[model samples]
Target chain A: MTSRLTVVYGVRASASEIKARAQAIAVEQSVEMPLSAIHDGSILSDIVGQVRAIDDRGNGAFDVTIDLAAATIGSDAGQLINMLFGNTSLHDDVVLSSAILPSEMLSAFGGPSHGLSGLRERVGAKGRAMTCSALKPQGLGAEDLGKLAFELTMGGLDFIKDDHGLADQSYSPFVDRVRVCAAAVRKASERTGHPTRYAPSLSGSYTDMERQLGLAREEGLDVALIAPMLAGPSNFSALRRNHPDFAFLAHPTMTGARVSPVLFAQLFRLFGADASIFPNYGGRFGYSLLTCKAIAAGLLGSFGGLAASVPAPAGGMSLDRTPELLDCYGEDVMLLIGGGLLSAPRERLAAEAGRFVRAVADHCYPRLSTP
Target chain B: MTSRLTVVYGVRASASEIKARAQAIAVEQSVEMPLSAIHDGSILSDIVGQVRAIDDRGNGAFDVTIDLAAATIGSDAGQLINMLFGNTSLHDDVVLSSAILPSEMLSAFGGPSHGLSGLRERVGAKGRAMTCSALKPQGLGAEDLGKLAFELTMGGLDFIKDDHGLADQSYSPFVDRVRVCAAAVRKASERTGHPTRYAPSLSGSYTDMERQLGLAREEGLDVALIAPMLAGPSNFSALRRNHPDFAFLAHPTMTGARVSPVLFAQLFRLFGADASIFPNYGGRFGYSLLTCKAIAAGLLGSFGGLAASVPAPAGGMSLDRTPELLDCYGEDVMLLIGGGLLSAPRERLAAEAGRFVRAVADHCYPRLSTP
Candidate 1:
């Protein structure tokens, strides 16, 4: 029985006291702890394991590892993790900094089945940081955006996607926008002999979302751009599990709930985001550099037996920041440059994006060829 | 366009500074206010009207409001409100305490379409305080829970529901469980001529959820219990819209993300919960009495402009505290008592619940009934 071990560390509380409390909690909720001398024959024993760990931050949060002997988590591993967080929520001073779960739980629900490696394989980007662009300034028509996509792929971006706000609005209906943009990207890819994947934004009423997915499929779009917060986290996992072949590029609309300095990074990865885009440290939206670094570590670092994920930092980024970002993020990162590139001249769009990608590649892996 | 006004109250910041920031956001994102005089316009203005009220909360949080004119909230009122909330979210420190909107949004979302009046009319308990009981001791079999439900309904609980944790575990497959329980309650109702309604827990995977609801409908259950956090907030609205005939009872499972003293209550109502169940003050959970009062007040109290909703206080509630709870939360409240009742003897279960309800009813509205 592979279990979740959450190591808690704090002060004003002894390990013995914490252990007693943990055992009590286990008995009160899950299986009873047999090791406790205080254990009575009255309650059912449900606890399978527990242990304490050191916290470098010296924060009041206790790091406790909980062992599950059975398949307590059904299909939705994310929800199960949420329940765990909820259970310990009665205490305020106690912070849940991290959670470790087995890969089986993720595999049980088909979590990130294609991850970064598989996605890169499909996109045919074997090495080097991939350049991605977003078609934005929402008020534009589908044809106008499609023309921009043509130039962007022609310029050098390996991937292009719709901005998170690009819902099925009158400015650009989802199906029409998807058809035009995907075709343009495909034409550019064919001419250049490089696969430039197009991911269209997906957000709407239930029927509308289903229609958007269907239309994307019909148009042969490579990835479906979805904001997990807008479409619901479970919705992303649900869609991904259902359409295993379609690459899920999750956006971050209305994602304020998950960005607290303490819990943001780990929770996002736990919810099964293959690639999560957060407003960078120095970016306009205000996530601290420390927070960004933690998010990167949480996603790419080995923990809970889950596979690594891509941490995409966007929002108010520019070409000059490419080296700095790549230097910080390393090779596994996805450099998403949106409005900054789009605001430039049409011809400069692709060239600037290509330049930015080349700079990142040169900075991260200097041995790799620029072409 | 009855636009949304988001009031963010925090430490005193310059009004011009705040307004400038708001205007910058409006232009950069939505309506496009020029950088020089960006403070003049707001996101709401694009839709309708704008009013920025900034107040210092002594704490670091600032209180600001953006009032939208009626034109902004056109035919798609529900979406209009969502857009309002979404737009303001792009900024920070805007702890949304209230949302002011016209009746059209309520109608569009079919809010408590059948509110307290309609609910009372259906249950045939118009005047007296309603009685409800949750069948629990989570690990029990379906037949055992159904038998308990039968006893409760027969012994005179107005409503019988499954404890929120009673989802589709192998011990109690939802379809078979709902069928047996609904039948048991129906038999009890037939015998006693008491119109006791049953609402079973229905939090499952997307497909399982749809199937569970279909089964609940087939089994003639009056209401379906849904934990918005465990499921999704949109799921509640979508379910209500899809199953117009059925009533939804929303629970606060794994909903701690929004339970901050500032935002929890009002947002729950806006997220479309007819009866929003939260942890009561002085329970095993740790919400302050003031916070609980605020939640209740926010639910029933008139805000900038929002509909009244039922504040359901559950989670580790005991009968001894019923009188105190009733005193704190006046009438028009649903007091959900779970584990305490489950601990009672089978014979005493219904009578104990009825006694508890009678005590609350008597304490709150003495003229109505007494045990």
Candidate 2:
């Protein structure tokens, strides 16, 4: 197996032009010049990406693996990205199916400064799948949402994150919200005697986010709800790398460009996501069952010895789907249900939370009784 | 006429399921639940996105304008993004064509910290199209690429940037490269009396990049070539907003998911980009003439009264296409040719630089003589 493999996966719907598209991706990504010029076999031949193997998965879909010369990516995440999906992403027909990062690159990125095990221990939801929810609708005041989070965690959630839409606004600034919410969760933990953490949204410009991260940490927040697409993957990865204590959960907002759930999950982990959230198969967003499973598999799979991160499948999940998700994902999953829970009667939130936790608990170990 | 309006752009490619898709976008984006469940029609309707108008753009493509409630986005940049493309981006068929941010959102998320006028003044290219090139083919040592950059700047290119492929690699460590390259350009600028600037690639995790930015500033570098997708758009925007003195040049790497150039340019500018570069028509990359033109138009077009940004067309641009580019883009354009100049014989570099600038000068203002 090649140490550096760049998988050129184009969409099945546009597979008629697969070979040409694959070749285009190779040249466009690397040399940014025509391939024919290298026919004379100069240094450019080795420097440019060359398609080594092609596999047709039938049904109009094909996977072409290109062997990128190790020197193609200049040891930085940004350059690696330029060579991966830079220009190709503009084309609707082509989709980046997958790529194997050089072990050195994987080591440099160091997938999720803290992975699944760390998070499982932090939230104290060991021996079963994790549970999380969002303080949502974007416009809630800090106090209102903090109280709501207090109630939910009191009902028993491992970690409560801010919805991707929740950012620093007049109604609820980031520092205020994070501080208030963290206090609420801490108070709830004291009452319930079950540890629950708050992962506030760190969504802003670098300085803005840096301050937010500092505040969250100062207030003893455990994880950060990072919008990788909105924030920039490198920024999040770097922050995660630097701050090893806090855990991270990725939110899927404006990440449609990474079409495949598997690629989405794999890249997120490689870049530094301890927990990546994806749309559930039968839910509102259009991901299929196979793709969702693929995302879960890739997240927990060994990649050049990189640690396995948690795959959190969200978007339109409810209490009823907990059993199915538990069976599918086993223990390495973080179930996120936003509107599914937020839309329920405010009074019934505690009851709903109890049922959700019980379902996951019962499914994880059917041989044993629920707590 | 509302203070906040979210423009909905959908594809003709998936028109068979138009209404359903439109409704899905409205629900998935805001509520993330079945619309029918909001039977009480209480505050949920006010909180959710409401589709106001839908138009058929000739073929199967249609434009649907949805007005999200004013409080949809918190004041922070991430919330705006979540409201814009978020979950809908997962659906391949749904393309975000164009969006309009309300005045308040626009005010909160200021477009470009510095615009066209600021750049022209800084570069001293007072009245014509600016010329720029990359120190590329990543494997070269810091001194080699730095000398190459010095020669290019001495030859008269306005802005010398690191190729997207050039990162903090062993081959050319970022600090070593930035210091050497900036020194080379500074030395050349002293000799030529030309105000050339070196924009190093700030491509690493947060701390890694923060150090690079500080180093570039200390070394008297004017701008930094930032990969928004790689660093996270929010990260770049934050860096740009905080460090207003250093100009930012946006590079298109790992940004293929943003399908439409028009929408791509609009969003980049909205977030914060002094200059936006895209693959040109007839380039090694597959952007069509129409798409490239649309990208240019969008950057220069007045949206929400934002200052105009420079639209740079790059990728496989040869010396021959100079006049046509001048005609198409007129004055406000940054013609970026990477390998076109770098691939030339070392001895001929000075002449090549002169001719490249001369062509743009002659086209922009025929009476002006090439210096």
Candidate 3:
């Protein structure tokens, strides 16, 4: 029997039109031609996507579940995405809701090399949620950004990452920036007596990223930030396979256009992201509270025995909302506060970061009190 | 003086809200923080994105233009995209309408190594529009797919490309498929006395694609198809630079969700696609006729003295509507008919393909008729 993966798409169509629409999607995704044109019976039966079920969710919305041949994926990460949403993404009415991949496929992908527990161990966080902050203002020099990183690290945050906007610009080349930030974080970690990790954003071509990773490794860095959508999914997966020791913090840049945040969290984890960052509810972006919860669940939930990835709720996150965020996401999360902390005076920056970190540490889970 | 690129965004906001919204976007995309946080005067003046102009297009729509520092992009293709649409793509109301890049940036990108004229030269088609078709229903084995390639080549088509869905599936491994199909196209080309180029769809990691390209080179294939989005923009740009002699036909799969099709055409050309394929107006996808024309123009128009790429209007294109397509796209386009020809019986496939080729060849330009 041919191995298959189930893909679910939320489609907008009336009850009278849904069946044909679902069938058309199956044919369009798989065969790319009419069924009558196919001569081979095996090709028709096995290769073509089979519509497993359709749930009418009322209000012109229907859930379409399709079983696609797993053989079609063939250990290629980009191809897997292409097969799932390549053509269908063109249709505005359809949203790729979820997928159920076979264990073999998950094994091939090797979900996460260093997942939630590994991340927790890296930061030396015993029980409470981890605290993370970003080094921002893209045009800043390497030394200046390093100073900011040092402040954030000194404040006792577990992770201080480069803003996704920071690339190999003349103002702050990747090499110079990585060296300074890593060293600064190390010095601060020694002073604070806490394990603080620096994650420099990885950009450019595969080769450029490889060289950057090498430089980062030289600085004793074990964590890195990457916008998987910008780097390309295949490149991200390949980088993960090549560097098993490094923990990847997946950024949500350029991702909102195609896949749902919930599905993206799962895919990022499968592609070896230790933590997946998303725009939290009541943030700069428009992701709803329900969608944010779903995204967190998708990252932390069990699937094919893969290690759980930590959900990093971010985008306009503030120090004041730490309890609420912790209440929403619980202990297995990374609360990323960027501009919220950086808005403080230069001398008070570390104190602001410390306050943010302490809040996460002190917050008691509402779930514990509910029972 | 810092070099800057002008980016245009279409925002959904009322007249009263447009100015603040535009100002917020400028700061959000650049400093990513409130102006009050930054003490540096230079950063405030130069680094932060400047709101160049905002036009209230009426009905809760406004076209906002902002100038961003070009230094933020470095020399990376992926970084360029990230800078342009990364975080902003998360906003559903904002569409990245277009961008005006500095000449230096365009020069760095080096649009289309083997472009429109080069593609026409390769296929031995002069003056008239080219005819192209895709090998479909992707499950067929290498030998069987090669047979279809032979039939299509025998029909006098200028280009025969593998369907975007066809990857390194076990049924037709990349090496086996490329070898058989290349040989079949060569055989048919010799018999028909017309050079028909075969473009094998490239899918995989950057390394995998590189290996596939090498294999294709060994098979004497001069042109290849790649979905730049799937390969990653940086990888695609690097591939073009690495293989300057090979012509790349870009496939628009998984593109519709983010950037406009018109902008994508220009970006693809700048990233070195010899031909850019998009879904036609009356096709399986929902691109409007006006959008299709704009896409064609974006590909063919002169930009920073870069070579023009051929616009390929595809997706459910048929032989019967060949005249209308030609009239709309003119001679600078590739009329790609895929499943429409494949829907014919097995024996009549070549004859149907021949009819498609003939329809393009025999059509009279409405512009010429007016003269």
Most TM-score-accurate candidate: 3
Measured by lDDT, the strongest candidate is 3
Clashing pairs in 2: A86-B254, A89-B256, A90-B256, A205-B238, A232-B232, A254-B86, A256-B89, B12-B60, B12-B61
Q: Which candidate is the best by DockQ?
A: 3
How do all the candidates rank in terms of TM-score, highest first? 3, 2, 1
Residue range B146-240, candidate 2, lDDT tens digits: 77887898778888888877777666788899989999999988888889878888877656777889999899876888877777766776777
Residue-by-residue lDDT tens digits, candidate 1, A183-286:
99888888878788898877644445667788888888757776654454566667766676677666555444323423434444555566666668787666
Per-prediction count of colliding residue pairs? 35, 9, 0
Ranking, DockQ, top scorer first: 3, 2, 1
- Minimum summed lDDT over a 10-residue window in model 2 chain B is located at B34-43
lDDT: worst 10-residue window of model 2 chain A: A34-43
Worst 10 residues of 3 chain B by lDDT: B362-371
- State the DockQ, from 0 to 1, for candidate 2: 0.47
**Per-residue alpha-carbon lDDT of model 2 for A1-371, expressed as tens digits?**
32465666655535567777677667766666544433334335566677776678788777777767666664455566566767667665677777766778778778887778888888777689988887876556799789779878877988788877777766678878988888998998899888888898877676677788899889987688887777776676667766788788887777775546687678788877899998888986667888888888899988878878998998878778888878777877889876677766777876787777777777854444669
Where is model 3 more than 4 Å wrong at Cα?
Answer: A366-371, B368-371
10 residues in a row with least lDDT, candidate 1 chain B: B31-40
